[model samples]
Every structure is written in C-alpha cells, then in structure tokens.
Target: MIDDDAVGGTRSQTDVVIGGIKQMLTSGALVPGSRLPIEKDLATQLGVSRGSLREGVRALATLGVLETRQGDGTYVTALDPGNLLSPLGFLADLQQPAHAADLLAVRRILETESVALAATRLSETELAELEAILAAVDDSLQADAEMDLESFIDADTRFHRTIARASGNPPLAAVIDTLVGRTFRARLWRAISHRGSVRETQAEHRAILDELVRRDSERARIRMAVHLLGVEEFSAAHADEDPEAS
Candidate 1:
C-alpha cells in the first residue's frame, strides 16, 4: 500500500513539494540521469523555500532517488541495486555512534537460547563445520598483527555464523547476522580492541565452545549472554568516559 505521505498531503507546503517532485519525476523534465536544479532554483520552481526543497530531496534520496556529488552537482543516480543499496553502509556509519552493546544485548536475548539448543542437537557434520570455524578463528588470532581489520572481522563473523547455523533455524541466524553485522567490526575494533582484545575474545569463545561441546545448553546460553552483556558494560563505561555521550 502507498503511504499517505506519498500523496494527499494535509498541508499546502507538503502538497506543493511532493506534488512538484512527483510531477517532475513522472514527466520527462527530470529523467534518471538528469541533474536536479540548484536548491534555490528548485525552491522557486516548486513555489517553496530552499529548506523545504532540500528536505524533499533528502527524503527522496533516502528512498534511493537522488545522488549528490562533491564539487559536482546533484544528479539522479542509477536505480540499479548497487547504486540504491549503497546507502545502507553509509547510513550504518552515521557519524554519531550509538551504544553498540545495547544493540548486542537485544541480539543476545534473541539468539542465546536458540543457539544453545541448536548446538546440543547438532549433527556430526555440523560439529565438523563448527570445528573448522574455530580453527580459522584460532589461525586469525595467531596472526592477529598480520590480519587486517576485515580479515579479523570475517574470521570472527564465521565463528558466530557457525554457531548460528547449527541452530537449525534459517530466519533466526539471518536476523542475528544482520544485527551483529559489518558495522560491528568497526565498533569492536575501536572499543574493545586493546593489544589483548583478540586473546580476550578468543578466550571467551573457547568458554562458549566448552559449554556447547558438553551439550550444556543452559550453561552455553548463559555464557553467551554474559559475554554480550560484558560488551554492553564495557561500552557503557566507555561512553561514561567520553564527553560526547555524557
């Protein structure tokens, strides 16, 4: 269903801005490759102020509509998947860093019980995969200085994905993957990564693996929960020390 905001604005300003943009888009005046007029010019044309015009343009950009270039002008970006999806990462890297551990806490609550039980019911083949992931994690840890941020992140992600996959629930793992995703590497590297971060995280993973290997679902679940909670506590303390968050 189309949103009310998409059409039938309650106010004249919204109506003028939205209606004008839609008109230009539907008409050939602003084709896919065409450059948007300057903000002042657009405001004049749309019978709105520059601020409102810019706001409307940003809203459309959020919906994968426009692209702004540095020193160059704003143009209608290609609506291809690559162009459209480029905003996801940039949005993820928004200048204001959120309390990451709080987000991780929610993820832990969602995944702990499920992953633990999944580990208990894992098949021999699945166990082999988990073993392989641990091996890779260890390999990366041993070469920590040589490994780039992405490499370390990939190894760690594989470790988590292995446990999530063993849970036998695709949707659960996918959600977990998205939550503790690519942005997590940047956060973890900055916050928790001292010289000993890898060793500390490796030890934590080992403890989690020990409980899972013994099929102690309760202990495994609690262990993972505590680990994620530790991250929350760490981040909170870090925020306390930072003037920005305070």
Candidate 2:
C-alpha cells in the first residue's frame, strides 16, 4: 500500500495515485500480473477519492501497464515491447501522408542496422524463405498485365519483416513492424502514381537479400539504406499526395 502521506502534495490526485502505484511497482510490492488491491482500500491508502483512483487506473490501462478483466479485477500487464509500443502504430496512422517521408527516414535508420544484423544471424531456412518471397515478386513483375497491388504489397511487407525478425532483436523488430504497417498506404500510393515503381522496389529487395545471403553486413546495410532512401525521396517529392485515396 502507498504511504498515507504520499497524497495531498501540490500534484493532482490522479498524479498522486499514479505515482503511488509506480512507487509500489518499483519497490517490488507489485509485479507483472499482480492483482491490484480493492478499489476502496487502494483509494484510502493513497488518500484520494475512489473516482480519482479510477481515473488514474484508466490512464494506466491505456498505456498498456495494466488490464482490467470483465469480472475478475485489474492486474499489471506483462509489459512486453509489443504491449508498450503498441500506441506508436495508432499515432502513426493518424499522420498525414505528407509525413511519410519523415516516417521513412526513421525507418531507414532502424532497418539499415537491422539488415546488417540479419546478414549474420539469419538461418539457411530463413534465407530460402526470403528467396521465395522475391521469387513471387519476380512472377508478379514478369507479366505485361497491370500489377496486382495487394499481392506486391503483401510480398513487400513480408520480405522486410522477415529480415527484421531475423535480426535477433525483439524490441527492434516490434518497432519496425509498427512503422511498416503505418507506411503501407504511402507505398501503395507510390506504386499507383509512379510507373514501374514496383519493379524498381522489387529490384532493390533482391539486392538487399543477396547481400544478406552472402553474409556481408556492411553491404546489406548499404543496400537497405539505399532502398529506403529511394522511397523517402519519392514520398517527400509528393508531399501533397493523399495516400488514403488509393
């Protein structure tokens, strides 16, 4: 329980409630999956009204720090990277298409390093899987027919995501996944407006995968950077293009 004197400082009651719970967490009084104390008792312990405590709890729930079961009670969450960073995708989705260049810039920095790591860490089976993804891309591009936008996009998403996961870094992979999901519409818009853009991107994916297969970390990083930089430049040039329309 929080100290009685923990509340009633210059801070708002909600802050007090939040801070008290934080203190309990840090002091090992709480752990992942620990059930919170009863509402009235916790309210009294924090020296705050039950309403204020509820407000604080709601805020924590939004942040993925806690979960309230339908009839069981509130408890601490596992606090994994996916849970904590889940809000990032939601926020990124709300940004204007004009901001895609900004998002891609960040993506480039993270993915370049991730690909470098993946060059050394990926398994033989994973390498074969990547080749298969690009093989599908090749088939998609070989025909004179109009591109299947959804098929191309799915392949594009899987290729990069496989590399990110192979980097052997869970948190990094989670963040890259979020960024990739957010940038989907911008990529689709580019493919629609820029003739042969899909072919260009597919070629770049081949280059990156080739470097990874060779286990050349430096070249893999370079290839990945160059690939994303092209997308960033294209997105930046068309700042007014609303990808949502595609």
Best by lDDT: 2
Candidate 2: tens digits of C-alpha lDDT, residues 223-245: 99999898888878877876655
Which has the greatest TM-score? 2
- Candidate 2 residue 223 Cα shift, in angstroms, is 0.3
- Looking at model 1, how many pairs of residues clash? 0
How many pairs of residues collide in each model? Answer: 0, 0
lDDT of each: 0.67, 0.84
**Model 2 pairs whose backbones collide:** none
**Model 1, residue 119: displacement in angstroms?**
2.1
Assess every candidate by TM-score.
0.56, 0.86
Q: Give the CA lDDT, 0 to 100, for residue 127 in model 1.
A: 68
Worst 10 residues of 1 by lDDT: 88-97
Model 2 spans > 4 angstroms off? 1-10, 143-145, 186-193
